[model samples]
Target: MSIQLYGLCETHSSEECNFYCRVCMFALCKECKKQHDIFEHEIIRAYKVNEVASFRLADLESLRDASDICPYKGNGRLVEVIYKRGDGIACCHGQGNVVECESCQYRLKSPSAKYCSIQCKVEAVMKMNESESVTNEAKRKVETISEESASDVKSFTKRPRE
Candidate 1:
């Protein structure tokens, strides 16, 4: 009905341990524990991050996929940290002026490359021309209908009692 001693120090062989080192998982006696505490207490607890150097594409890929902190070591030298932002440079693109394709979201390689492929560009132009033709035809029909209605109204105004 009494508590038992599960931890015993190896140094003393028969001494009951009072402290446990979780990092190394070692049981220590009072004297050894006090020594470790004295040295550990002298060490600093907080650390700071200096500016990071240039980071490679591979490094950023891992950071994005894993959602982990920068893996750079030694003053953060492996790569520069770039926080993703809406108004900042895009994720897949470099620092250059580019436009999006009218039909799809693909970024145009150049100003001349309006769409992602030739098919898209051609299709867009054809759609524009077809819409223009339809609009013109509709306008002509409206004008003709208005002219005929005006003539009918004039004839009614000139008619005698009938």
Candidate 2:
């Protein structure tokens, strides 16, 4: 069978020499072999061309599978998980700096806990205060109502039969 090989340099003794290094598994040409001092006496061995090709094909297939099973493709699941655990949010650009907002749930793009705008920050703080106040007031009202109801029940039960 006839095979056309592109990019293969025509040189003598090409068949005798391995296509790649057995130690590093890097593809090498005939000139590279002499330059690197690779010989039968050399400690390092050379891998066959077919073996190197098979290894590369396997690596490509594994990479494709890994990309398919990756969880943080579009959802940024890894970042979200880290942020939810209070470890701070990582920059979208893969920087080590983690962005977080102390006053609100909004994540910043920098180390500073800044919102998109000053107004948004202020509104967030105000909303937080308002909600806290409402909760406290409700608790106070419930306690007062309970006390009044208890007093009324006591007085009604203590009334003599007249």
Among these predictions, the greatest TM-score belongs to 1
Top lDDT prediction, candidate number: 1
**Tens digits of per-residue lDDT for model 1, 31-66:** 656667744332111112243212332434533321
Per-residue lDDT tens digits for candidate 2, residues 1-162, read 011112253464343433344344344456655665645422222222322211222222323221211112122212111111122333344545645444333445545434432223345567888999999999999999999999999999999987
Roughly what TM-score does model 1 have, to 2 decimal places? 0.33
Q: Estimate each model's TM-score.
A: 0.33, 0.31
Off by over 4 Å in 2: 1-96, 100-117, 160-162
Record all residue pairs in model 2 with backbone atoms less than 3 Å apart, i.e. clashing: none
